[model samples]
Target: MEPFVLRGPEATLSTPTPADVDRVAEVCADPEIATWTTVPSPYSRADAEGFVTQMVADGWANDMMFTWAVRPPGEVDGPVLAMMGISRTVGAPGEDQAGEIGYWTAPDARGRGLTTAAARLAADWALDPEGLGLVRLQWQAYVGNWPSRRVAWKLGFRSEGTLRQFGLQRGVLRDSWMASLLPEDPREPVEPWPAEAPRP
Candidate 1:
């Protein structure tokens, strides 16, 4: 599939390139990122290179995923502010089409709403008939990832409760919170949620 770019209010989302290796390595190396995400611990230059070169390439080629590197608007060549993607999900027999969204924000770019904006853009694109035309977009995060949960909630994903030992982080099983956004759901925030609600 040919690569494409999606421009949003605050950021531009595009395919990752080999040129982004160094910056990707630097950002993924942050302990906070490693702890919260599945990114390799003690991330290395080689890992970053493969992520941009091999992983992204294969994902697009196979139609299994679509990954985008987010940057400030009009700064497509600038440092990556975050990485986001939707992966096609292999559902059970007789299930509707589905995909799962995942993302990680750069440490320096936290609290700027860049990821949220980019996520909305991606979700819109994924649900468009001209795009992937997926029926629903799933979201999951290890329990306690309030930031990620907030992003999902802000996008109107219905909280679907928790999955026990749903994810593995560094060889340890961890519970995860799950949610879903359907084509019929409003993109804006829905009913107010409890401030103390558990997060994925």
Candidate 2:
């Protein structure tokens, strides 16, 4: 699986390089990021280096995960505005394919649609028959993450159901909200936005 870049009208996503290590560490240090994401609480420079130099490289080379560093549209050297990825999983014995999508936006990049744009680019690429050829994409967030839910909703992920203590955050199992998008799904809100999120 060769590393690739995805571009959209509002975002560009490419694999992270060693140069992004500092910014990665800085973003991961955000208290909100630590609370919502599974990144190390006491995230260190070493962790960022591993992510940029090892985890990201291995994930792409092994075809297990395809992660990208999001930036402003067409700005390859711009600051990392967010991070998004798809962790692929083998489906049933004969199923085509499926994967889980995950992402986090940099503090200063929130409130705008950059994160959503990046996600749309990832989803479009991953689900394209001529691209990853995946049949389905799954999105899961801790039950209280309304921001994540809104993004998933805007991507047309149908609210499936909830799994009690099914998602591991940091270490403990927490209740999780689950949703799914298929290749044929429309890229529009599939259901009413959850109450936690203000109506669009």
Model 2 CA lDDT for position 172:
98
**Model 2: per-residue Cα lDDT over 40-88, one tens digit each:** 9899999999999999999999888999999989987688989999988
Cα error of candidate 2 at position 44, Å: 0.7
Off by over 4 Å in 2: 92-95, 193-195, 198-200
Residue 193 of model 2: what lDDT?
Answer: 53
State every prediction's TM-score relative to the real structure: 0.92, 0.95
- lDDT for model 1 comes to 0.87
Q: Which pairs clash in model 2?
A: none
**TM-score of candidate 2 to 2 decimals:** 0.95
Model 1 pairs whose backbones collide = none
Q: For residues 108-129, write the lDDT of model 1, one tens digit per residue.
A: 9999888899999999988776
